[model samples]
Target chain A: MQALTNRVKVLDQKPLTFKERLYLPAIFSGMLITFSHLFKKKATINYPEQKRPFSPVFRGLHILNRDEEGRERCTACGLCAVSCPAEAITMESAERQKGEEGLYREEKYAAKYEINMLRCIFCGLCEEACPKDAIYLTETFAPANYSRKSFIYGKPDLLIPDPTKEPEAFAKAQGGIKAHKEKVR
Target chain B: MTNHLNLLPYLSIDFALLFEKLLLIIVVVTGSLVVAMYTTYAERRIAGFLQDRRGPNRAGPFGILQPLADGLKLFMKEDIIPTSSSKWLFIMGPGLAMLTAVMTGAVIPWGSALKIGEKVVSLQIADINIGILFIFGVVSMGVYGIMIGGWASNNKFSLLAAIRGASQIISYELAMGLSLIALLMLTGSLSMKTIVEQQMQGGWGGFLGWNIIYQPLGFLLFLICAFAECNRTPFDLPEAENELNFGYHQEYSSMKLGFYLFAEYINMFISSTVMATLFFGGYDIPFVNEANLANHWGPNIVALLGTVCLLIKSFLFLFVFIWVRWTIPRFRYDQLMDLGWKKMIPLALANMVITGAIVLWLNK
Candidate 1:
């Protein structure tokens, strides 16, 4: 008990010496130090207008991709669901109807798809697990929301409207994204 | 009542009298505040220049409007009161700080007598007979502001700092008071203006004249004591950040904190003015007394010019205060105490004794 109490740093310690107690010389030294820091380069950045470079491996928002002809390649194989470590992804599979040919790559397609972002740890396991050239994690750093319910994403919230999108979705998709997609195919 | 004397038919309101008093107070208060604000800017800029950095040009061209912006910011900030704090006392803390600050400058002879249009005005607020003692009296009370603020804060860090400060200041005040005793003895008057007069009329040349040459030891003791009194570097334990973060005003926020900070600069300025007045001969142009200048243009002009010269000297002394602050390292708490009591007190005593003996021998 005594040893533990002794280990604690007491606020009231000891008396200063006659000279040390006066404290003028020491104060001057401290001022000199703070004054020195005035001239040193400041470590401030003007953010937002200009952004910093992100690493290649930076995990961000998830996206489902379309091929060159604007056709989704997901087969509703359930491979991504099995590989998702966080159990964040959920899906229901339905067989492609007679007229819905080539709309999905496989005979079966994901009829309902959802990802609970709260549970999705951004580990990219689902991205890696899909054999077909479909799911991907993009390089957007921010996926902020006001509430927990807002975090969970559905197909409409996460998906691109047009498969043959003229504008880029992912910032990296302009160059390496297409190349990486071809390699995956 | 009686078949009485007739009342004056044209008795009038003394608006001019009221106006003069109001104008003087306004001028003095405004001047002190302006000086105090710029003193902070000057301290930062000088320190920056010494360390090779541009200081505070961001606020307004060379930070000319920095103090004004600072004042506006402080005024706009929320006035916070700690839940546990004694509300009245906490509010009183900064009030006392500001009061003591401006009060000390009241006796500073800023400029000489001058006629604007027809009315004569002297730069100082009061020419009190107890000028030096008045300074000491007011300065001794400055610690109370810190003490009250710390106590009202209800914080351990502030309390510790307050205790350190009260004891440290009280200890040094003795040496400071003692050092001045010799100066008072040599001049034989408490009036600051009269002391300057004595320094002038002495048969010895003005070169040999000033109190600095006469009581050199007194000047050393007084200077050191002034440093301790003002809580300058080597003596600034009250606000030592390492041991007690933010010192006595740790709990203070916004303009309350600004009050404490601005008051420190004011004290430094006041002390510098006092030192110049006492030792260097307040506003006395060397070898050319106001009487000589009066030969050229009335006594008022000479006195006015003399006042200007004195102000220049005092302003230069203020720069010296900043210079010393940047150069010296703070002494350890123990070292500070030792320097004050063990060193300054004994030297002050010996200086007094030696000065007295010399005076007696010279008279013989």
Candidate 2:
């Protein structure tokens, strides 16, 4: 006998008029609406040829960062491996040998770093947990690969280009995320 | 029979004429197949555009090669036949559909006769006097494809859909026939060539010539019935995908299934051409004197242009068919029946009576 939220409405069950029964006018109007849509901008981005820009904080694939001096920043601390919800990261630490200072930023460095991209959730937690700013989630996502072994990204796959040796690639790898942040600020 | 056979040799066989007609048949069949192929592509593209999305564009430039790829895929698929099904009838169903679909094109006058060297070749395959009746007969037979296919499948959904398709076609045929009666009265002939020629007769200036101007209600009824006959959206209850689980061809696989699907597109193409021929002046170029053009550029060129014009008209109709498909939702089966039997039949009957009276008054 009492309505709950005053949202209930009576159904319009009245019989249709002669004009409504004809259906042509309504059909024509609906057709006109659809026809107009032919000129409207399409929502799809033609995935291969064009791509939508990711947000500044958009976390995608992991990239092992290199400092401006082209030295690896990771000190083999294993914080990223601990913070990774997916447990996708693994590494083997080796004490920096003599004459290896140019290669590594710290006394202790990762000898073998791998990220199973199939397991990585792109949550950016690993990036947040890294103390030395060794790892970051790049704007680029993981690409498709045929083999499961190919998805197990090794140091060669995850490492950013040496800035001093390949400045163009290094800048390109860092360009989107940094520029997006700057623009937002 | 022997005497007739002997006279046939004296008739000289008209080998050149026979060859030309045979060539024309091949051209017409292949051309229709190509159009139907492109129509599937267009339907997807138009549907995409209407929904504000990009459709298939990966195969080739703007996906022009998509249909070829689709045909290849269909060809490569594994053919399966249910063990319970009637072997011959199940096989014959899609074949029969393909036959009936292509047969309708035989009587449609594609263009004026072309003059070649020492012979005049008509673009039409067969300018049968009872062209409209022939179309009706073939279209009616099209139902057997669905009926036999559905029944042979031994599936309840398929059987139900087949019954629905048969009833829908049968009900709509009444209204369709009644509406065409008025047009036939106006044209004074059932021959498509004669109707088109009549439409083209009274100069190039007035809109009064096209049957749509005179039998507006009849044209509307015919158009609606045509949509019903084509089993397109708004009347696609027989293949209500969600409800009927793929309908009459549920058991079909591989190219057999492709044939059933291809038959629908062929039906749409033929219906569009028929509508153009009956109501819109088939190959008559509007606002241009074709005779003058023929005199200036030769009959062959003019005939080609007329063919192009007819194609353009049919394409516009096809576009509208696709447009309407994407715009409207399917009708309830009961509503479909009600519309076909009660509303359309009465309206078409009334239109026929009024047109007959007017024709009589004009004659008096």
Candidate 3:
């Protein structure tokens, strides 16, 4: 019975030496090893008080973006709805009225946009499919809610804050995503 | 006969002594419960630290209030007794377990006597003549609790677990007793106070005065047996969660379950205390003349210091108990039995004989 490889050694069945049989020395060494860990840095973070930093390109919840002039950029093209792997996005388009130039960037605008957060996998396919740079994945994820109805994020829930009126919230929602794109360019 | 009859009133139980003993009992019982409660918290905290994680820290500062929260939860839980089980025996199981666990503290000498006015009060609850034997008896009775609990549960797994627990205790008790016989031979007394006082004499090197210096093998054997007696890890096959589905207390719920768990921690505390008393010189402070301290300060202060020293020793033992639990994996059932019957028994016997021979030679 030749061995298949030199590395494959037979099991050692020899009787234990007095020291090995005693088991104290080995047990003490093991105890000392565990004792050393007492002084080492703990790996756990106190979760609520401290948070791990997210990467710049980290895709989380979907947000409907607005142009620099605070006009809605989405034209309800349905490309995002088609590309969304989870089929979470749905919207209704309405023609821009004669006096609504300041409200909408284009003639066709989304009157009602809804994303079912429960079905969303946050794969960022919708963001990639959008030609108007309207739908983007934000750094913040969806928070826990009581009901399924609450999880269905509507236009109000998904829209970025009007940048002109609330610059702080708009910048916070933007996070490092804009800076990440600028660095790449 | 008339003179003896006249002295009966004076001999009738001293009111002061009765009062002191009652106070001591209350202190001991309450202290044991508090320490046992904290031990559960400490176990989790220590386990967490070893594994590089934070344990329960939400209850209070450093999770000091965790045990209280746990106790409240257990209390609030609905008490359930199985329909098929023997209700009386099921109820008595945990009660007996707790009783036997706390009863071992009676003979342990916590410290020296305190001098108050003209009356000297011993710190121990009862300095019984056969203190070690009393501990053995109580510890053995602990098995009955588990046996009854398991048998009354009407579950086969619980019954099997109960049998394992009983047999393990019985098998290990032999080697444990054998190892202690050597220490008994050296001390020439079964009384715990006498053994402690003997160690306090500090012959030759002061630091080497403890019985552990004389009977290292005996101490090691006794320690292993103590682990078995407590049904801690490595000898915890009786409560092997995976195989036995929580073992003897499988059907127990609410405070009955809590009682079983509480009894385990109390048992660990008592075992640690006994190990400290027998091998580590109970309340004897090492490398310093306690008598000199008593002379300089007061007997009360010295007694307090002794009590603190004993507590420190017991805590160290408890830490080691927890440490070993987290470090070592449980042994296989056959391996556990083999270790108990074959390896431990022979080593214990040899240690006893060698100690006896050495004691004889030293006397010669």
Candidate 4:
């Protein structure tokens, strides 16, 4: 048969030589190779003590964004809930009261928001659908927990720390994603 | 000359002799067990290094406490007994394996005799006339453990693996025995102590008397057979995890399984010591006149140093064992049998015949 491609080559089907049949020299050479590997640097990272750097575009847990003044960025427009492929997001909208201007960034605010972590595919579709930069995917993943019910994350769980009250925590939480965004810009 | 000096004490048994023997036995058994434990750790570490990875560096520094942690885990595990299995025979298997492995150490000479004041203390637990034969008897018995365990399990895989192990050991034993016969002819005595003493005397630079120089072919044959007998990789078809799934110990659980694994390491340790004693000059410190050293630094000190030398030699053998395990892949069943019967047997026979002719010619 003709060759399908130039890369195809015929294999040598010759019998083993006397030295090859002996096996000791081959075994010795193989042992030498493995012995040489003893000095080679190991590939292990000693995990828990050290961790590898995640990629710049790595998306993990959901974080509800807030403005610099610490007021909620979400207007309860339900765009993120509609866009979520996993159907994990849910919210209840409420009309902001007269005295609640400090808490709400818009007249309409989310009274309750929940994301079922088990159901969330972490595809970052919800982050893309948000018009007000209200939601973002942080570089920190969800931790292991016992009960199934605990996986249903409430607004308190997803919300970023208020910048005015906990500036260090908010900055630390936003550090990786913000740096990555600045690099892209 | 040295054998005569050592033999006189065996004629009569006193309280001191009995006490000395008991102490020696305790020390040897405990020492072998501890060495076997560390061997598991070394095997893993060496295997990891060969693969360009770190293995078991937790629990303690460099995983020094890994064996202890493993032992504790095995003990803590549930002891499961298969309902269909023979309870009595199933229990006896690992115990028999461990017993035979430890029993072979009785004849190996740890060091030259230590002289403390007017009394002389022999380092060996037993100086039997048929020392090599006793070792052979014990090593052959080791297969029974595998056989019984496999048979008792009533599992098809276990039984098949057992048969493979038994046949492999039996086939290799022939080559091993034939190889040793050539060395026995040269040494002219079956006693382990006598063999070492012979090697220590009348050779160039004090180290040329080792059996490896005279019968390199015999040593090679014996070493290959030892790997087979120990059921290490390349010959570990019986415990072929991919094919047999724990093999003979498939039904075994907890400490019983631990016993089987521990027995293998002990077997490796004992075989290494045997190889060192048989070919590498057991307790005979290379390139040094031990008698002259004893005069300068006391007999006890020299004896201790000699023991240390034997240990060093055995450890080197153990390292080679681990190294080979990592380097070679397991042989196919047919290939294994072909190597044993067609290759090893014929080579060993040729080696023995050549050795015999040389001995006869030299004597004439």
Candidate 5:
């Protein structure tokens, strides 16, 4: 009757002898192990006070890229939205006016690109699928919210305040997209 | 050998004074709570010391603000009620742990009686005729809280752990209770105050008085039982992390979880104090006549100082509990049962018989 659970059942160990059952020595031994760990470096990291170094590949908040001239580079391409498995992305494409060609480098541009923060699985597929190299995910994880609706990251919100925060990253994003666009032209 | 001096006339009469028991009861319970809260802070500091890290320094100056920080954290947390749980029982689980933890201190003689302006006040809450039994009774009832909470959790692991815990505690309590029967026979009184007063203080030709000397085997058995009672390692199978996640409080969160954890440390503190009081002569010291101090400083000051000494001993015992907790490994369920029933019970029985025979031969 007792063996019905799906959980992994450990092997049954033999019982201790009467003297062996005198738990003092064994209990003392176990205490010694914990005491050793008491000297071991604690696994607990004070999250707020001490920030752990994140990996370069660490995907965090999604950002819409800006080109070398500090101009918004997203060209209303629906590729990111279409590729997102979580359906976290939403965008409204608008035609770029005659004077704004340098701003977008495309006739069609994204007027309102919003990613529902709640649905985002942080899968990075949107970043991967963006042909314009307009979207990239940063290593920022500070998006806890009281309401689900507040998580929707629109164009302005998704834009990074400072790509220069990671200089190497800014140059990389700019170089990759500029080359890709020049090749297309 | 030091002649048996009776301090009962002083203690019993002083305790018999009206309103004294009530005050004793209040101080012990409330004082135990304060001590219990601080014990947690001490445990953290010790663990930090062993690890070469300063623990909990963010709360206040050197984290003197830690306990208050903890209290505030608990208070501010969301009090969650599970839809599947028996709301009443869930609420009552930590409540039971807390209640049982504090209640046992009611009869502990923190100090001997001291005389005030016009009256004498005993430093204990109640020195009942069946004091040992009263402690046993209350201590036994504490298990119900865990049982109820675990059962109500609607979790198989909790239920199993609770059953394991309940069985282990019940079996060990028998041995713990029996081990004391020998001590009672020697003392001929159940009142804790009388028992402490009875100890031949280490005066009069190197008196080795505390029951720990007379009953070394009993002390061994009793300490093991105390460890098991507190659900500490290696007897901490009740909330075995490998099997039960976070044990009975697995589903609990926020302040509810805080209450469960806090109540456990409090139980440990109270149990250690009880062990200190029962076997180590409560608050009495060898060669230090509490009565002598009473004569000079008056009874009230004597009682106050004695109470402080008892607290120091209890705190030392509490440190041991924490020390042992970080020292031992948890026992498996079967191993726990085997130790309690097969080993502790028999050893306790044998010790009692040997003690009985020796007393008989000496008297004869």
Candidate 6:
């Protein structure tokens, strides 16, 4: 039984001395250590009142992107659904009708878009696979919900706020994306 | 002289004394309950700080209302009784535990007597002559609560934990009693009021008169045994969750479980008060002669201040208890038994002998 490597060192299995056996000194030292931690900075971020800043590249919940004109950017390409490792994404495409130019960005639009949030691994593969820049992972994590049915996010749940209608919400949702774009530039 | 059956004079009620004692009892009981509630909050907060984390702060500012919230939640929980358990004993366990816990407060002298217009009122609920012995007797009876609860639970783990709790308390009580005997030898009294009075009589501005000066060895032994008696960590084997689940209260639910938990905190509070009374000069304001203060200020103010001083000392002891709990891990069963039987008993015996010799020699 030779040493496997030079790094392998034997543990000291010697009997404890009288002082060590008393344990008072060790206990005192431990107490001092814990007492010192009383002044140390706490590692908690008070939820609701305080939040830790996420890195620019941090991936969280998925969000469907909208163009400057508040029209959907997705052209029903099905690239995100194909590339999704979790197969969380699903959609049904429909031809854009006349007088619906304000709603859809292209001739064909996603009529029914869904993401099974329970199945989502949150790896951002769908965002990576999209060629249209139609999907992005925002800095908002999924909130708790009671039913399994509630986790199946539909188009309305995934879609970002219309910039023209809710400027504040749209800006807040776009904060991480703006920072990410600046970092990339 | 009128008749042999004329016991009316002896049986005459002192209305003021009765009123004062009744008021004091109400105050002490409610005060200890409030202190116990806060102690739970403080324990959690201290544990958090020790581990470099912030404890509960959501219920109210700094989570001050956490104990109330916890109590409400426990009350709201469904009360579950095991079908196989003994109905009466299972119910009686927590009640007995709580009864013994609150009963220990009766003899503790909170402050010097307060002087009203024509009457003097003692702050103690009952200044029993054998105060220390009374505490010991009641504390020993506390074992029955655990024993009955564990046995009645009809679970093997609960029964084993109950036995451990009983034996632990018994073994530790010997050393605890022995250590207190050394203190008793110096004071020559069992009355807690007399012990504090003796401590307040000497030089060095009343601070040197504390019993801790004479019996450091005894104090150390007593403190260790106090922790054991309270079933605190390093001696908390009876409630070893990893091994015994919830111990004697395993089958308990709702307020029954709350009672057991509340009893533990109450035990900590009372032990802290006892340690203060026995060794740290209970209700004796250090560095100031209380008599002079009572003369200068009103007796009521002085009495209130003395009570405050005693509370401050006991709170420090409670902090030390929580601090030690967070610092040390639980002891092995064999190690616990070994410490109690071999180490504490011998050390306490030696302390008692040494203290007795010193006391006799000083008188000579």
Candidate of highest TM-score = 6
lDDT of 6 at B298: 77
Give the CA lDDT, 0 to 100, for residue B83 in model 5: 91
Segments in model 3 whose C-alpha atoms lie over 4 Å from true places: A1-19, A179-185, B1-11, B204-206
Query: Per-residue lDDT tens digits of candidate 5, residues B1-364?
Result: 3344555445555445555676667767767777778888998887675555667877777787788788888888888887998989888987887788788877877777766666666667777878888989988998997798888888888888788788888999999988998888778898877777777355541136788878888888888898898888778888899888877777787877877777788788777777777777677654567667667977777667667777787888887787876666677777788878988888888888887888899889
Question: What TM-score does chain B get in every candidate?
Answer: 0.90, 0.96, 0.96, 0.95, 0.90, 0.96
Provide the overall lDDT of each model, using Cα atoms, as 2-decimal numbers. 0.78, 0.90, 0.90, 0.92, 0.77, 0.91
Positional deviation of A67 in candidate 3, in angstroms? 3.0
Better structure of 1 and 4 per TM-score: 4
Q: Every model's DockQ, to 2 decimals?
A: 0.08, 0.80, 0.67, 0.84, 0.22, 0.84
Better of 4 and 5 by TM-score: 4
For model 3, what is the C-alpha lDDT against the true structure? Answer: 0.90
Runs with alpha carbons beyond 4 Å of true place in candidate 4: A183-185, B1-13, B202-205
How big is the positional error of residue A68 in model 5, measured in Å on the Cα after superposition?
A: 24
If scored against the real structure, what TM-score would every candidate get? 0.65, 0.91, 0.93, 0.94, 0.67, 0.95
Model 1 lDDT at residue A57 = 70
Per-residue lDDT, model 4, residue A26, is 99
**Deviation in Å, model 5, residue A156 alpha carbon:** 17
Worst 10 residues of 4 chain A by lDDT: A176-185
Interface RMSD of 2: 0.5
Error of 1 at B129 (Å): 2.0
CAPRI accuracy category, model 1: incorrect
Native contacts recovered, in order, as a fraction for each? 0.06, 0.86, 0.61, 0.78, 0.39, 0.78
lDDT of 6 at B132: 97
Local lDDT at A118 for model 2: 94
B1-364 in candidate 4: lDDT tens per residue? 7998899889786889899899999999999999999999999989999998888889798789999999999999999889999999999999999999999989999998988788888999999999999998998999999999999999999999999999999999999999999999999999999999999995663589999899899999999999999999889999999999988889999999999999999999999999999999999899899989888998899899999999999999999999999999999999999999999999999888988999999999
Best by lDDT: 4
Q: For model 3, how does the per-residue alpha-carbon lDDT over B196-301 read when each residue is reduced to its tens digit?
A: 9989887542357799998888999999999999999989999999999998889989999999999999999999999999999889888767888889998899
| lDDT head-to-head 4 vs 6, winner | 4
